[model samples]
Target: MNPLPQNMENALTGSQSSHASLRDVHSINPTQLMARIESYEGREKKGISDVRRTFCLFVTFDLLFVTLLWIIELNVNGGIENTLEKEVVQYDYYSSYFDIFLLAVFRFKVLILAYAVCRLRHWWAIALTTAVTSAFLLAKVILSKLFSQGAFGYVLPIISFILAWIETWFLDFKVLPQEAEEENRLLIVQDASERAALIPGGLSDGQFYSPPESEAV
Candidate 1:
């Protein structure tokens, strides 16, 4: 063919250069992609390393809270010797404000247990722990109404409830095992992008190029 126009030749050369680059990217190894995912997960876990320490601190405070309640119960109600005198000063755990506090404590325990389970990659453990914690708290409430009139007896469940929830929220972003699977499914999108970049038209979907595979996918 006769010599093409200067601009058309330049455009064709540029297109060829771009196509070569895209092909280079599309030849990526799947193993490398998986390795990148593992690297990211390791870094993410490091960021949450202090979750256990936080749980311990909350548990310590929870214990102190229970002890304080016991002391208050003993002093306010005649040392548990006189039942009639004890009734007069016992702060009713069932009263609206106290009831709300109990619920809050319970929710906190749920949070703690959930996070702990997420860290362990055991969702069933989380569910079982939550059920046991709830059941224990419910039993305490029932026993308090039936057998004891004072608030001291109710403190353990409240403390347990608080501990569980504190555990849950500690690592809210810590992905459970199932969530990791779901997340891996999205990783295919990254591979597709890389393949598109080295193709003749780049990404025909009008998508932008993915960075080097070494970069976080």
Candidate 2:
């Protein structure tokens, strides 16, 4: 075949260079990969907000039930008055103290839940709160068994435990992952901007590239 014209050869060379540059631009950069992962994680978390809210409601109900139980116990057994009674004692101290302590713990857990609700972006708070609530529920179940309590008393704790467990799972697998991904995306953008700033004549318009300037005649 005849040799290509000089302009055609130059055009072919420029096209190949342009194609290579495009490939470089389109290649999977680590930062872009992380951004994509974050997007997926955020999507996953979006579907679980309702589940988290349901768990929060369950926890609220459990707190109310425990409070009512505490009041009833105190009324029936003369809370502090029956401290020395064998049937009234649950832990090492007075049953009244136990009731108070349990109430305080439940209230703290409720506060955590409220914080989580007000600041849903804070996955750590939700995770910590759910973990503590689950622990309390487990303890309640064990104590009930030790004391030979009726099935009715076991019901609330069991349900609360299951809900807490589910909440924790959502926090770990969905909420937390999404939060981490968002942080990663922010970091990547910040890094890109910073890098762009350092480049000579670079235009930091949310990207890491320098704009082309017109050649002088």
Candidate 1 C-alpha error for residue 102, in Å = 17
CA shift of 83, model 2, Å = 14
Q: Model 2: residues >4 Å from true position, as ranges?
A: 1-151, 198-217
Clashing pairs in 2: none
lDDT (Cα, tens digit) per residue for candidate 2, span 6-120? 5565666676677666444444355565566566557556654444555556556656665565555444554535632543354542112253336435644754455344545
**Each model's TM-score, in the order given?**
0.38, 0.41
On the 0 to 100 scale, the lDDT of residue 121 in model 2 is 60
- Provide the overall lDDT of each model, using Cα atoms, as 2-decimal numbers: 0.52, 0.52
Q: Name the runs in model 1 displaced over 4 angstroms.
A: 1-48, 74-119, 146-148, 151-159, 169-217
Q: Tens digit of lDDT per residue, candidate 1, span 1-217?
A: 3344555656666776786665556555555766766765664666443444465466446545754564565556556445323443555544212432344455446545555444555445445655666775676566446236455555545666666555454434444433565457557645554555455542442343433222222
What's model 2's overall lDDT? 0.52
Query: What lDDT score is found at residue 48 in candidate 1?
Result: 42
